[model samples]
Target chain A: MSTRFSPILICGAATLFSACESSTTTGGGVSDAQSSDAQSSDAQASDTQASDSGDGSSDGDDGGLQDASAEDVVDGDDVYAAEDALPSDDVPVVAEDVQARTDIEFPSDVDEDSVTDTESPDITETDVPGVDAGGPDVDFADVDPGDVDPGDVDPGDVVPGDFDPGDDVQTTKGPQLGEPCDLSIQTWCGDEAVPTLSCEYIEAEWVWTEYNENGLPCFCHPASSPGPAICAVPGFVGIDQSGRDRQAPSLRALRRAARLV
Target chain B: MADALTIDFDRSGIIDPVFAHFAIPVPTLDVPPLSGVVRDAAVRIWVDRARSEYVGVMIVRKLHGLLVDLNAPMDLQELALRMLLDEQRHANLCSAVVGALGGDSGVTFDVPELQQPRSAATLESQLIEMLVGTYACGEVVAHTLLRHVVKALPKSGFRLVLQSIAKDEVLHARFGPTLLASIRAGEQASWIDCPGDAVISALYSAQCRWMLGRDVVDARDVRLFEDDEQARAMCSVGVSEPRAFKAAYMAAVERVRRHARSR
Candidate 1:
């Protein structure tokens, strides 16, 4: 599970952290009102990601923040735009890549312990959108921290980065039937090598009718019944010896006939 | 006058049979010859017993196939072969009983077709279906119904014969779960994914067909011994009352479900 960090995520986190610091220094400390405003900014940044990818724009340095205000902008729209630009021939962004990227980038701020206690809670509460957007790599270390709200990015709207097609392909084989059975059609043809028996889908079900080399129904049993329809009398000594008509005689009538009543 | 039909066990190779131990002196009925009602009831029992024995033959054949296909142990195959012999004796005994009642066990139905491998996705699935259909549901219900019958019958030659059959059936009933357990343990997978609902439905279908004698006796022509005592007696001899059979069948299904879950 390789994690590919988007430059947009780092720049956005740095810009959001800078804004928190500036707001705290100017306002004396982070307040309830300030936290609420930050959440609103996060929501706007998410909207920016959504619109950039939705409209098929080009992946550039801008984080699709043209429509969003400075206080509520995040980077990463270009990543999505570049992902969208790929000729529609390739496989869609794999879910694992997006998840891995989001996991690595979103928790970085928390791991560095850069924000104050009041600021940390607000940043931690921010919702980062999980997106897979492909774009040229940009250096976050060289970029200036601008006023942007990382929390505003919706994980869902984030464009996924490039994914290796072969990584997730599973090679294990599922269990095979003894015979070549088509589950959808409900027909079974025995292995070609042996070809001892074959069944046909008849009467809305499958039955093992004997088959020869030519695949014709053969007489398997002594009784001449082919399908379930052929009715034959069961061998019963009582019925054979009685030679009496089939009739339901009442117990009372039987007792009377036997002189027991 | 109808001469009493005697069963020669020596010819059947069931020397000193278990039934002989419980045998009571055969009673001489001074009553007139068997009436139509008695004859009908006796014939029904005889037919049911015959069908059950025939099914035993099919089970043995299926078991042999399973042994080859699954590489099942020799013990299981041997037990199945033994059951075949028991079923044969049971069929003959039933025929003799029918004759004793002054009726002949005639050719009423054809030898049952070897059960088509049930509709399933895999060979394992087919084996599970057959195992449950025949043993878990079929034999278990048979044993339950037969136990009730054995209890209702008075100590007599008829009861002795039934008891003998029931004894073998009880052992046959255990084979299904035992084999299933072995397969599950060996294969390292639950081969029979029998849901509670499916188990109930399968049991209900098999038991209802058995109770009504759907394949053996024409539904319209089948006789019900309306009288309470008569119906109970009929059930004792394997002609089950529909309601009683349903209750017993449901109980057996529940037991199977519990056993499955426990494993």
Candidate 2:
């Protein structure tokens, strides 16, 4: 398509340059014969240059002359002779290329006359050529919304690998040793009401019971028992066999017990 | 009377004794005769020393029992036994000094009855309570008082005796905490928990009474001197003033409190 339009485009460019030169020389002090000679020499030079570069054919020579007349008509009436020269099959291609070039080169030439000529329905029909070249129009609005199932967007529908709801659940352990225990709060207390026994509170009255086999204070209970009992000394409380007490241990006695002295 | 009184140091029952090497030459009966106040004070100091020594004996016995009960590996038993001998020596030394000062009757206090273990809970608690009360509180207070006395007294046989006893008391004071540390580091760590506030409170109260002699109502009657000058003199020779003793007692209590908190 570009091959057939190259010669015509070249001829038109040459003719426009020649017309511009002739218009510039028309009011000069040169005589009419000299002016005509200069104009004929310039036109012949433009035609030769157009033929050499446009198509390498004799048709470019006549095309250049016709182009000059077309330029005169266009200057007076604002029209292009290249559109008439274009073949029917190549008309849309050539018009598109020309329109594109005009838009790029002379974007600021949007006079009312140019807009009316370039923006006509006939020029818009040329856009169909692009579609005919295999660029299909996609109408997203025609797609059925029902084809996409709404369940696909549901979070529960997606299954993540290695995910087990039970694995996230944690089992709580009961209160550890030495932790304070509350009788009311059974959860942390577990099976026992009190976490551990303390010497602050005496659970039972200490009595002077018979001695056990270990010869310890076996006051009321055995020596290993864990409860309050009267120690051998008056006004003293302690476990029978444990040797633990609320009072300070007598160092003098301990020395004797160890039999150091 | 002989020119110089000869003490029967050999009969004191300290085998291969440390103080045996010293040739203690007793002074004349009097450059000035022993006054009533000085005599009373001297007798009292000796009596208290004897009683404290006896208590020392009992403390070791309790420690031995505790070690056995807990099956603790540290054999404080032997050290405790040795401390018993040292206390006995201290008691005799105080008594001898009392005799030289004109209190010939020697330590007038009766043999104290055996005190039962007061910690009626676990064996570990009992051991801890005993250690805090005896070593941290009792012996520490004794060491402070004796140290002051040793500093106040002039360089004499009496000061030497108090110094010797004070040195032993300091070791006795350290025994408790050392044993506790060992227990904590060993398998018995579970048993050695920080004592609750109530136990510490009871222990502190007991320590204050023991240190200040508040537990014994007649302790004031044993004052070594009547006047300030005489009291100062007594303080110089291992008899602490009542106010100073109380202050030292309170300090010991605070120490024990801090020790408990750290645990």
Candidate 3:
């Protein structure tokens, strides 16, 4: 199943070049391609505070959390490692599992293209958990649906990966983490060249495009296609989906393979 | 050879396909030699971490089941399934780390019975709450701690293993927000109010206890091993002390808060 080079890969390639051209300063100081401030500051501060902080400290405040430079241990740069030398699209997929998937024969009546999540039939079952263990903390009854403010956990509160390029976009008033999106091909977030795919509903009807500011991609459930889906890009995170080709990009978002240069 | 899960399973004769997949090659895993107290402590710390990752298999399996059975959403089920694999991969890496640290990689791994919180609630409510705890709050805890640990260690095989785990964790940590965003405006609001923001506070507390200890009344203030000396020592060799964990936690908490308030 050799697909054409996905634009997401192209985008990653472009970003990779840009990231390299501008990755000269391994110091704590911000670089040109530093996408998100929160993540950069967060990474810098964590590295600093962890080294400086002993157990004597009571709280993890920004009090002693100074932005320490990386020049001390700047012997090697992981930026390239993060880009090329790290894992390929050959992520994790059991060979037997892929073989089993290849053997599946959909019903004769099933129209693969026309089918959406709601109409799609439930496929064979994989390993699942039986709810034998018992527990409870908050009763849903206490959380009055009608009275509760629309604001719960703000999607903005989502702490993006330490080096997520998306955070740079997300910080600029992007959709909250759980905001609704659609599968229609015509729409691009603010940027025409999106990073990867995102979700409309939580179930399986998904496509992959760039993770633009418009659609951040929602979580998944009842996925239309289910199996071990892993993609292996030449220079980027493996970007393939079991069902929709675009799904690889969405999963890539889940991987958020940050550039740890 | 010292992996706890594989220790009991015979590798001879017809083997399972899943186990075969564990043979995939990872890059930059050259384990640096360790000695003295640092070696002793690194072994101890990594062994405990491996066991924790071992338990993670159960946790991910349970979470995957919850997502599928509840029919929460399409992509989430897929995400959980991928997460299932990621958890196993992390366990594998951690076991490898334990071996490199001079300890037997085969620690006492336990498969504690899975506890389904909000057992009395509707499947919808349970799914929402669990997502908050498991991905949002819980992964946040894991990511923060791991990131802190990764920062403390130099470039070594141990660091590479932890860094790989961190890559997956960072994504999982962001799942909470994405899930919550979907829930807020979805159709289920008619029957269920929201996924419950308090889910973060409640689930985070529960996670702190699970990771640190049972007596951790407040995650914000709890010290690792209940001793500062042990905590500081652990921080040096890539095993964060309790205070270090708290620092990352606070940072994670603030990230979520800032994003929330950004609007």
**DockQ, all models:** 0.01, 0.00, 0.02
lDDT of 2 by residue, A1-261 (tens): 111112122222222224323322211222221111111101011111111121101112121111222221112222211222211221121232231121111112323123111100111111111101111212212322223322223211221223233421211122222333221111111111111122110133212222111111222111212211211111011011111112222333333454564
- Lowest lDDT block of 10, candidate 1 chain A: A116-125
* Tens digit of per-residue lDDT, candidate 3, span B61-82: 5566666555556655555555
Candidate 2 Cα deviation (angstroms), residue B73 = 2.6
What stretches of model 2 exceed 4 Å from their correct place? Answer: A1-261, B1-32, B104-112, B115-122, B185-229, B232-237
Candidate achieving higher lDDT, 1 or 3: 3
Q: Which runs of model 3 end up more than 4 angstroms from their true locations?
A: A1-76, A80-261, B1-33, B109-118, B187-246, B250-263
Candidate 1 off by > 4 Å: A1-261, B1-33, B111-123, B187-224, B228-243, B254-263
lDDT, residue B156, candidate 1: 43
Considering every candidate listed, which one attains the maximal DockQ?
3
Over the stretch A125-177, how does candidate 3's per-residue lDDT look in tens digits? Answer: 11011111123222222222222221232222222224233554332223334
Count clashing residue pairs per candidate: 32, 35, 42
Here, model 1's chain A TM-score works out at: 0.13
Report the Cα lDDT for residue A249, model 1. 30
Q: Tell me, by lDDT, which candidate is best.
A: 3
Q: Candidate 1 - CAPRI tier?
A: incorrect
Candidate 2 overall Cα lDDT vs. reference?
Answer: 0.33
